[model samples]
Target: MQSSYNFWLVGISFVVATLASYTALDLTGRIYLLASARLRHAWRLGGAAALGVGIWSMHFIAMLAFSLPIPLGYDFATTAYSLGLAIGASYLALHVATHEALTAPRLLAGGTLMGVGIAAMHYTGMAAMQMTPGIDYRPSWFAVSLVIAIGASTAALWLAHTLSNDDARNVLRKRLIAALVMGVAISGMHYAGMAAADFPVGALCGAAKGVNAEWLATSVILFTFAILIVTLMLSRFDARTTFLVGAVSNLNGQIVRLATLDTLTGLPNRATLTERIERAIHSSRRQRSLFAILFMDLDGFKTINDSLGHSVGDEVLSAFAQRLLLCVRSSDTVARLGGDEFVVLSENLGSREDAGALAQGVLDRMRSGMWTDSQPLQVMPSIGIALYPYDGDTVEILLKNADAAMYEAKRAGRSTYRFFERSMSEAATRTLQIQNALHDALAAGHFTLHFQPKFHGNGNSLAGAEALIRLHHPQLGTLTPLEFIPIAERSGQIVQIGYWVVRETCRQIRRWIEQGLPSMKVAVNLSPRQLLQPNLVATMLQIVTDAGVQCEQIMFEITETVAMHDAPRTIEMIREFQASGFEIAIDDFGTGYSSLAYLQRFRVKQLKIDRFFTNGLDEHGAEGSAIVSAIIALAHSLEMDVVAEGVETESQLDMLRSMMCDEMQGFLLGKPLSADDFSEMLRGRMLTT
Candidate 1:
C-alpha cells in the first residue's frame, strides 16, 4: 500500500513552527538590548531556554497533527532525549551569536551547528513513534531536507545580526520584517524535514501511551502564544522606561549648566567662582600650599560700550573670555563677574612668580587687541593679585584685598598689576575717613579758595592767577589740596568740591572787580570726575551767572591725563565751554601720555609746563630745559599760550623767559593768598599799573 499524508496536519505544523521561530527571535533581540553584562548574560540563557521550549512544543504539536494508518505511541525516554537535544542546540546557537562578532564565517559555523542539532532532534523524535511497520526516509529527500535546514539556519542568523546592529530611524520596521522572514524560513525548514519522512501502512501497536493528539495540539499552541505575548510586552515596557530615564538625566545636566555658567561667555559665573575659591582655600590649608587670585578689570571697556553699542561690546567680552581661558592652566578657574570684570583662581601654585607670569601673559594678550566683525578693539587689563595665607586666609578677605589692590593698580596708572599690601588697607581706612569728613566739610563751609598770581614773562605785570582750594578742619588744623584732593576724586566727592571751587572763584573775581581792581582771568582746576558730569557746562555757567561775573573772567583748567582719558567727550565739552566765552587750559601738560597730535586737537587757551620740568631747569645742563623749550614752542605753534609753573629762582625765570614763555606762576612771584589778601594785592597792582 502507498503512504498517505494529511495536508491539514502539515498546515498546522507550519503555523506552530512559525510561532516558535518568532518567540526565539523576539527574546534574543531583547537580550541584545540589555545594558548590564551580567543581566544580558542571564537573559541570554533564559532566551535560549524559552526558545528550546518553543521548539520542543512545535515538534510535539507537529507530531500530534500527523495522521497515520497505524495507532502510534511515544517512548517517554526517547521523547525526553529529543527535547533535551533541542534545548542544547538553542543554547549553543544563542551563545555563539551573542559572544562573537557577527562575521559571515562565524555566522555560517553557528548555523551549521544549529542545523545539525535540530536535524538530530527531529529524527530522534521520529524514532520514538512506535508502530508495527517502521518508518523510513528517501535518501535524496533526506539530503534535500538537511540542505534546507542549513540554508534556513544561515538566513535566520544573518537576519538577527542585521537587526541587532541596525540603529537607523526605522529600526522597528526593520526588526519586524526580519522577524517575519526568520519565522517563515524556520517553518519552511521544519516542513521540509517532515516531507523527507515516509511511513508504510501496518497493524496498530503501542509501546508507551501518550496524550491524545487533539488535546496536546490545543494545549501547546495556546501556551506557546501566551508566553510569547507576555515576553514582547515586557520587552517594550523596559525599552520605554530606559528612554525616559535617559532623557531626564540629560535635562538635569542642562539645567545645571545654565545655572552655573555665564550665558554670553560660557565661563563660570560669580556664584560658581565663589564656590571654587572656597574649596581651593580649604584644599590649600591642608596641603600647606599657596595659590593666587587675580582680579581683572578691563580698561576702557565702558568707552567701547558707549561708542560701539552693546552688541559689539558683548562680542568683545566673549573674545576676551576665550583669550583669558588660554592664559591659564586647565586646573585653574577663570570666571566672569559681570561687565568686563573677570577673576582667575589658580590653585597649588609654587610661588608668586607663577602668578606674576600668568598675569603678564594675560596683559600681553589683551594689549594685542581683539577683533570683531566691524573693527578691531584694543583693551588693557589692570590685574590685582592676592596670595593665600599672605593676603588672606578666607574667601571674603582675599577677594576684598584683591579688589583693593586692583583699584590701586588703576590709580597708579592702568594696564598694570599690583599685589595686595598691608599699607593699602591703612590707606583705604584713611580714605574712608576723608570721604566721611569731606561731606561734613562741604556742609560746614570750611573750604576756601586761595589765589596764586601769574606774571607776564615779558614784563612782571600780573596777568592771571590760579584759584587753589584749602580746607580748615576744626580738629585736623589745615589740610592742603594734595592731602584731600585724591580722596575727593576717588570717593566721587570731586564733583561737589569742584562746584564749590568754581562758585568761590567767580565770587572772588566779582569782589576784585568791586574793589576797582583791573579784571584778570582766574584759573580753576577741574577733576576728571567733574569733567565727566553730564551737567558740567550748565553747572559752571549757572555758577558764573549767579556770581555776577563774565564767563571770560574764569578759566577752567584740565590736566592732559583727564582730557586724553575720553578724548571725544572732552573735546566736545571743551568746545561747549569755548562757545560760552570761557577759557580752556591744558594743565600739567608734559606729565601725561597725550601725544602732540591730540594736544593740537583740543580747543585750549594755555598749556602749563608741569613743575617737574620747571624744578629740573635749576640743575646743571638740565635735560628739562630742552623739554621745556620744545613744549613752549609746541604750544605757540598750536596757537596756545605757555605757562611755566613752580619757578622758584631767577635762574629758572631767566631760562623760561629765554624760551619766550608767555607766563610764569610760582612762589617766586607770590604765595597763594587768601581772598582778602588777593584783593588787597590786586588793588595795589592796579594802582601801580
Candidate 2:
C-alpha cells in the first residue's frame, strides 16, 4: 500500500517554516552588528537558540503533516535529543562565522558542520514517531535532500557575510533583501528533506505513548510564531538605536570643528593657533630644529571697511585668508587673531633666509591687490619675524618681539617686513622693568603728591592748587610723570594709580580743613583708563567719604582726549560728580579735538588753557591773543570759568588778567611744591591779603 499525504497539514507546515526562517535570519543579522564584545557574544548565543528552535519546530511540524495508515505519537526522549542537536549545531556555526572574517575555507567548514547537524536532527526526529510500521527512506531521495541542506547552508553563510560588509546607501533595504533570500533557502532545504522520507502502509507498531500529532502541531505553531515576533521587534529596536547614536556622534564632531575654526575665513582661530604653536615648540626642542613666527597686520583694510561697509570688509578678509593658505606649506599653520591680524608659523626651518623668503612672498602677494566682487582693492602687509632659540624660546616672548618688529616695519614704511633685533628685546625688557618698579613704588609709598598753587586772575588772592604725581625711586631717583605714566597706562596699572591719587588728594584736603585753613578746591587729573572704570563715580565717592572731605572742595580734571574717548559714558560720569557738588574741568583744552558741541553738553565748571597758547600770550602775539579771547568768550557763553596754565612771566600774568581768565597757575605764581610748602604758601597769602 502507498502512504497518503495531508495537503492541508502540508500547507500549514510551509507557512510555519517561512516565518521561522525569516526570524532566524534577522537574528543572525543583529548578532553581526553588535559593538561590544560581551554583548556580541550574548547576541550570538541568543541567535543560535532562536535559529535552532526555529529549525527544530519546522521539522517537527512537517513530520506531523506526513500521513500514515495508523495513529502517530512521539518518543519524548528522542524528540528532545533532536532539539539539543539543532541548538548545539547552530551555536557552533554562529560562533565560527562571527569570531573573525568568514573566509571561503572557514565558511565551507562551518556550513558543512551545520548542514550535517540539521540533517541528523531531522532523521532523529523522524525516528521518534511510533506507528503501525517503522519508517523507511529512499536512498537517492535522501542523498538529494542532504545535498540541498549543505548547499543552502553555504549560501546562507555567504549572504550573511556579504550583508555584514555592505556600507553602501539604503543599507536597511539591502538587509531586508538578504533576510528574504536566507529565509527562502532555509525553508527550501527543510521541505526537500521532508520529501526524502518514506513510510510503508499496513504495518503494525507499539501503542502511542507521547503527545498526539494534531495537538503537538498546534502547540509548535504558536510557540514558533511568538519567537518570530519577538526577534523581529528586537532587531528593529537595535537598528533604530544604532542610527540615533551615530547621528549624535556626528553632531558632536561638527560642534568641535566650529569652536576651533573661524566661521568667516575657515582658518584656525586664536586658541587653536596657540595650541599649534605650543606643539611646534615641543617638537622643535626635541629635534633641535628652528622655527619662525611671522606676525602680519593688514594696512588700509580699515580704510576700505570705513569707505564701503563691514560686509565688503568681511569678503576681503575671507579672500585674503585663502591666499594666505596657498602661500604656506602643508606642514605650516596659518591662524587669524581677529580683525586684520594673522599669524603664520613655520617649523623646522633650516635658516633665517628661508623665513625671510616666505615673508617676502607674503608681502608681494598682499601688494598685488585682492579682488572682491569684481573690484580690485589695494592692501599692504607689515610682517615681523622672530626665530626660535635665537630671538626667543617661548611663545609669549616670540609673539611679543614679533609684534614690536611689525610696528617698527610700519614705522619705516607701509609695505615692508622686519626681523626682530637685539635692541628690541632690550627695550621690551626695560618696559617690563619699569612696570615692576611702578608696582613696587606704589606699594612702598615711593610716590609723592606736589601741589601747584593757583591764584585769582584779577587779585593776588590764592585759589585752589592742582595736585601732580612725582615718583622718588631709591635707585632711579625722582622720576617725572612723562617717564613712567605711559608705561603704567599700557600695563593697565593706571586704574590703581588713579585711585591712589584721588585718595591722597582727599586726605590732603581733610588735613587743610583740620588745620583751620580756608576751604580751597584742589584739582586732581583723571586718566582715560580711570574714566572708563565702571565704578568710577562710586569708588571716588567712597574714597572722599572715607577721608572726611567735602566733595565741594575737590575738583576732578580730565583731558579733552579722555572726554572724547567714550563721550556718553564720560558725560554720564561727569554729571554724577557735578550732582555731588564736585567741579569738572577740561584740562589741556586747546591741544585736543574738543568740539564746541561736546563742551556745551558737558556740565563742567572750568576750562584750562594749554601752555602753548599761554606761553605765546606773553609776546602779545595777535594769534595767541585772538585764540585766548575766543576761548574765554566761548567759556563765558557756556557759563563755565577759564584758567590759564603754564604762566611763567609777569607779561603772561598781565595778558591772562586782561583776558579775564578766572585762575592762573605757573612758575611765576608759585611752582609745584611739597604739601608742607603749599600750606606755608597758603598761610602767607592769607596774611598778605
For each candidate, give its TM-score against the true structure: 0.59, 0.61
lDDT tens string, model 2, 1-689? 45566677666666665665555555656667777889888877777777788778877777777656666677888888999998887787677656557888898888888888888888888777754566677787788778877877777667666555324577557666765665566656666666676667676445365667678788888897777677778877886787789779888987887889888888998889889888988998999999999998887676577447799899888888887877788888999889998899999899999999999988876667454435466667899999998888778888989877876687678679999998877766766667778988888999999999899999988888899999898877887888789878756788899899989888888887788777779999988667767788888989989998888888999998778755777788888988777889999988988877878999699999999889877565888889998999899899999999999988888878988999999999889999988888777767886
Q: Which candidate number would show the highest lDDT if scored against the true structure?
A: 1
Q: Judged by lDDT against the true structure, how good is candidate 1? A: 0.80
Segments of candidate 1 deviating more than 4 angstroms: 1-26, 72-77, 100-105, 131-133, 165-167, 201-209, 248-273, 297-326, 335-341, 364-382, 407-416, 422-689
Tens-digit lDDT track for model 1 on 204-289?
54553687666767787788667656666766676677668877988998889888999899999988999999999888999999
Question: What TM-score, to 2 decimals, does candidate 2 have?
Answer: 0.61
TM-score leader: 2
Error of 2 at 14 (Å): 14
Which 10-residue window in model 2 sums to the lowest lDDT? 369-378
- Cα deviation at 271, candidate 1, in Å, is 4.8
Mark the regions of model 2 whose C-alpha exceeds 4 Å error after superposition: 1-291, 295-331, 334-343, 347-384, 388-400, 403-419, 440-442, 612-629, 648-655
lDDT of 2 at 187: 58
